[model samples]
Target chain A: MEHSSTVAGNPVHDNHGGTKEIWRTFWILLGLTIVELVLGYIMIGVESTGGRLGLKGAIIILMLAKAFYIVAYFMHLKGEIRNLVMTILVPLSLLLWAIIAFLYEGHSYRNNRNTYDAYTRERSNIQSTDKKADEKGMHEKKRTGAETME
Target chain B: METTTAGLDTKWWNGGKSPFNVEYGKLMMWYFLMSDSFTFGAFLIAYGTVRFSSNGWPDPNAVFKSYPGASETTNAPLVFVSIMTFILIVSSVTMVLAVHAGHERNKKKVATNLIWTIIGGLAFLGCQAWEWNHLHHEGAWWGSNPFANSDGTESTDNFTNFFFTITGFHGFHVLSGVVINIVMLVMTLLGTFEKKGHYLMIEKAGLYWHFVDLVWVFVFTCFYLL
Candidate 1:
C-alpha cells in the first residue's frame, strides 16, 4: 500500500523509528515513577511539615517531568510545527494564576474559619479532646449525628 | 519531497495550507486534548483548594493500605496503587507502539498492541473497582469518612468526596478510551484505514489514550502519594 506524503496539501513529517525511542521513554517514565514511590515511602517517616512539603515539592516536579515526556514523545507534540506547540502551551500558562489564587483563597478561608467561626472551632476542639479519651469508636458514632446538622 | 515555492516561503498563514502542517482532524484533536486538560486541571485544583481549607485530612497511607486477597488488617501502603500506576504506564507504552505501527502501516502489529492496551485499561479499572468497594465497606463515601485524620482528629467528608469524584472521573475516561480502542481495533481488522490509505484515526485514538494516562499521573500524585 502506498500513501501520499501530504494530507490536504499539508506536509506530514515522516520521523518514524522502530520502537527504540518508545522503549527509551517507557524506561524513563518507569524510573521516574519508581523514584516517586520511593519518596512517598520515605515521606511516611518524615514528621515535620517543612520536610514533608519539601518531599512533596520533589514529587510534583517528577510528576511534571513525566507529563512532559508523555505529551512530548508519546503524543508526538515535540515533532510538530512550532506554531502548534505554542498555541497549546500559551493557553495552559493561565493555570499558574488559577492555582495561586485558589490556594490563597483556601488558606484565607481556613484562617477565617479558625478565627470567626466559633461553632466549628468548638466542634473541632471537642473532637480532639474526645480523641484523647481513646473514645474514637464512640466519637465516630456521635459524629454521624453531628454531620447531619451541617 | 515536493516543496512548492510557496511551501519554502515560510508564509504558513498565507491561506492555502495548514499552518501547523498537520491535517485538520489531528489539529482539532490536539486542541480538544488541550481543552480537556483544563477540565482536569480545574478538578484537581478544586481538590487542592478544599484540602487547603480543611482543618484535618485523612492519611492516604492508612486508607489505601489493603490490597486484593490480603487480610483485613493489612498495612501495606502505596503497594496496590503502585501496581495500578504501572499498569497505566505500561498500557500507555502499548498505545505508543500501536501509534508507531499505524505509522508503519502494519495492520497486525497495530491490532495486537491495541488489544494489549485494552487489557491494561480493563485491569486498571478492575483494580480501582476493588479499591472502591473496600473503602465503601469501611464506611467511606461521598458524605461519610470513617478514617480519622493523621493527627487523630475527625476528618471532613471532603477527602473521600474529592477522591471518589476525581478518580471516578478518570476511570470514566479510561472506560471510554477502551471503547474507542475497541472501535479502532475492529476498524483495523476490517481494513478501513487500509482502504483509506492512512491510519490517522489510530493516531488520534492514541492521543486520547495517552491523555488518560497523563491525567492518572496527576491524580495519583495528588491523592495517593501526597
Candidate 2:
C-alpha cells in the first residue's frame, strides 16, 4: 500500500504561490512596530509633563494597530474562510467591550475617591475656621468685661 | 517484523494522513492554533484592564531599569527587549524559509533553517532568563513604592503581578516552541519526515514557530515597549 499521493493530482491541496502582498505585509508589520516604539517614547517620556492626551491613549492606539496586523496577517483571519473570521472576531469584540467596561468602572471608582477627599477637606476647613472665629469673639467679650469692671 | 506486519492492514490509517473527512491534519493544527490564540487574547485583555486601572503607572522602562549610581535617574529604555523582538522576527523569517525548503524537498536546507530557528529561540529564552533575574526591588514588601503618602502609605498598583504572570506565561510558550523545534530538527536528522512521506509536518511546525514569534510581537508591545 502506498502512503503518499502522486504529485500530479491532489485535488484537496492547492499550491497557492506566494504573492507580493505577503512581503508587503511583513514590511508593514515591521515598520508599524518601529513607529509604535517611537510614539511610545515620545508620549510616555517627553510628553509626560504636559499633554491633554497621555501615554495611555498612545499605548491603546499602538496596541490596536499591532493587534490588527496579527489578526490580519499572522492569524490569516483577513483572507480566511468567510464564516471563520466572523466566528473569531465577534467573540473577541465582545471580550474587548467587557474589558472597556471594567476599566471605566475602575476609573470612576478612583475619581470618586478623589472627589470625596476634596469634599471632606473643604468641610473640615470651614468648620475649623468658624470655630476659631467664635473663640475670638468670646475672648473679646471676656476682655471687655474685665475693662468695664476696672 | 511485527511493526511492519501491523502497519499492513488498517483502512483508517493512511500513514500520517487523516481519516476524518472534516479536515486535514494540517488544518486541524490550524484550528488548535486558533484556539490557543483565544487563550493568549484573554491574557492580553486582562493585562489591558490592569494597566487601565492603574492611574499614572510607571513606564516599562522606568520599572525595569537598574540605576548604576544613586544620582543616575534615567532608566534603560527596553533596549534588551527590542533586540529580542528583532531576533524573534528573524527566526520567523527563517522558519518560513525552512517550510519553503521542505516544500522543495531540500532536506539539508530545511535542517539549516530549523537550526537557525532553534538558535534564535534559545537566544530569546536566555535574554528572558537574564531579564527575570535582573528584577530587583527596593521595598521590603514587593509592591510598595518609594513615593508614599503623608501617612507613609503606598497604593497597591499590582503592576508587577501582571508583569510576571503574563511574561512568564509567554516565556513558557517560547520554551515549548523551542523544544518542539528541537524535536523537528531531530526528526529531520533521523529522516523521519522523509520516510513519513510528507513535508506537511515541517509546514505545521513552521506555522507554530511563526505563531510564537507573532505572539511575542504583541507581548513585547504590551509588556515592554508600551
Candidate 3:
C-alpha cells in the first residue's frame, strides 16, 4: 500500500495528527492482507485434510480481525456514539447466526445425498441384471419343474 | 418549526424529530446502509454454506492468481487481488483525507483528495472489468466454474453463480461510488459547498465510500482470501 510518509525511516506520524493515524492503519491493513495471502498460499501446499482445515480456520480468524480493523478505523466507527454503534452491531449478530444454521443444514443435505445416490445406483444395477436374465431363455427349472411337480 | 410543549413526557417512539443531534440525512444513510449490509451478508452466508457442504472447493489462490507482468504459468496466489485490495484501502485513505479536509474548510485539499479518491475508484473498477473478462475466457462464467466441475461442464456447480452475483453486486456499488465522487468533485470545484459555507456533503459521501470499502473487505475475504 502507498503511504504518504516523508521518509521510509521516519515515524508514520507527521505534524498532522489524524493523517498519521490513517497511514498507520493503512500499513496495518496492508500487512494483514499480506499475511492472509501467505497463509492461503501455504494452504495450497497442505495435503492433509486436517491441516487444511486448521489453516482455513486460521485464515478465517485473520480475516475477521482485518474486518474489524477496516470497519472500526477506515469507517470511523470506533469513535462513534455508543448508541449508534449498538444500532449497527446488535442486529448484525443475527447474520452470523443465520450463516451457521445454513451451513449445518447444507452439510446435512450432503450426507443424505450420498445415501440417495447409492440407493438409486443399487436399484438400477439390480434392474439391469434382471433384464439380462429375462432376455435369455433362463428361469432355471422354476416354470416347468413347479408345474410337473404339482 | 412548532414549539412542542410536550416536554420529556413525549413517548420515546414519537416520530416527530430525532431525539439525538444526528441529522436526518445522516440517520437515513445509516438505515439504508444497514439494509445494504444485510444483502451482502446474506450473499456471503450463502457462499459459506455451499463451501461447507462441498467436499473440495476450488482454491481461491489457484483460481484467481494473476499479476501484472506475470507469466502464463506463474501460480503465485492472490497477487492481482492484493493489488485490488490495496487500491481499495488507499481509496479509503484518500476518502478520509477528503473528509478531514472538508472539516477544516480547506477547499483545495478537499478537491485534491476527492480527485485522488475518484481516480482510485475508477482504477479499481477497471481492474475488476479486466478480471471478469479474463476469467470469462478462462472457462469461468456466470453459469459455470471451470474449477467446480470435474468434466468442465457448465451450469452445474453453484460456485460460479454466487461468485458472479456477489462480485457483480459489489462492482455495481463501486461504479456508483465513482459516479458519486465525480459529482462531488465537480460540485466542489464549482464552489457549491463554499457558497453554502459547509462541506457536510463531502462528509456524507465519504461515509458511503467508506461503507463500500467495508463491504469490499468482506468480499475480499470471502472470494480472495478464504
Candidate 2 lDDT over residue span B1-226, tens digit each:
5465665436446354333322355566766777777788778777776555444454565555542332324455655676787788777767767776776667899899899999999988887776765452222123423222212223343555666777788889889888988999999989997896656687778768777877787778777665
Error at A91, model 2, angstroms: 3.7
Which residue segments of model 3 deviate by more than 4 Å? Answer: A1-17, A119-150, B1-19, B68-71, B148-155
Q: Proportion of native contacts found in each model? A: 0.57, 0.11, 0.37
Overall lDDT per candidate, in order of appearance: 0.87, 0.62, 0.73
TM-score, one value per model: 0.90, 0.70, 0.79
Model 2 misplaced regions, further than 4 Å: A1-24, A48-80, A113-150, B1-23, B66-74, B137-157
lDDT, candidate 1, at B8? 44
| Tens digit of per-residue lDDT, candidate 3, span B1-226 | 3326555445433554333335556667777888889999999988888766654455566568776566556676777888888899899999989987886778999999999999999989989998887666455666545553211222134677888899999999999999999999999999999997777788778878988888887898788766
Question: What does candidate 2's lDDT look like per residue over A1-150, in tens digits?
Answer: 244443222412332544344456567767776777676667544644445156646666766776676556544455455455565456556666766787787677656655666753343233222111122344344334334443
| Candidate 2 local Cα displacement, residue A44, angstroms | 3.9
Estimate how well candidate 1 is docked, as a DockQ score.
Answer: 0.44
Residue A113 shift from truth in candidate 3, angstroms:
1.1
Q: Is candidate 1 or candidate 3 better by TM-score?
A: 1
Q: Please identify which of the two predictions, 1 or 2, would achieve the higher DockQ against the true structure.
A: 1
Preferred candidate (lDDT higher): 1 or 2: 1
> Comparing candidate 2 with candidate 3, which one achieves the higher lDDT?
3
Better of 2 and 3 by DockQ: 3
In lDDT terms, how accurate is model 1? 0.87
Question: What's the candidate order when arranged by decreasing lDDT?
Answer: 1, 3, 2
* Tens digit of per-residue lDDT, candidate 3, span A50-87: 99788778878877887788777766667665677788
The alpha-carbon deviation from the true structure for residue A8 of candidate 3, after best TM-score superposition, in angstroms, is 43
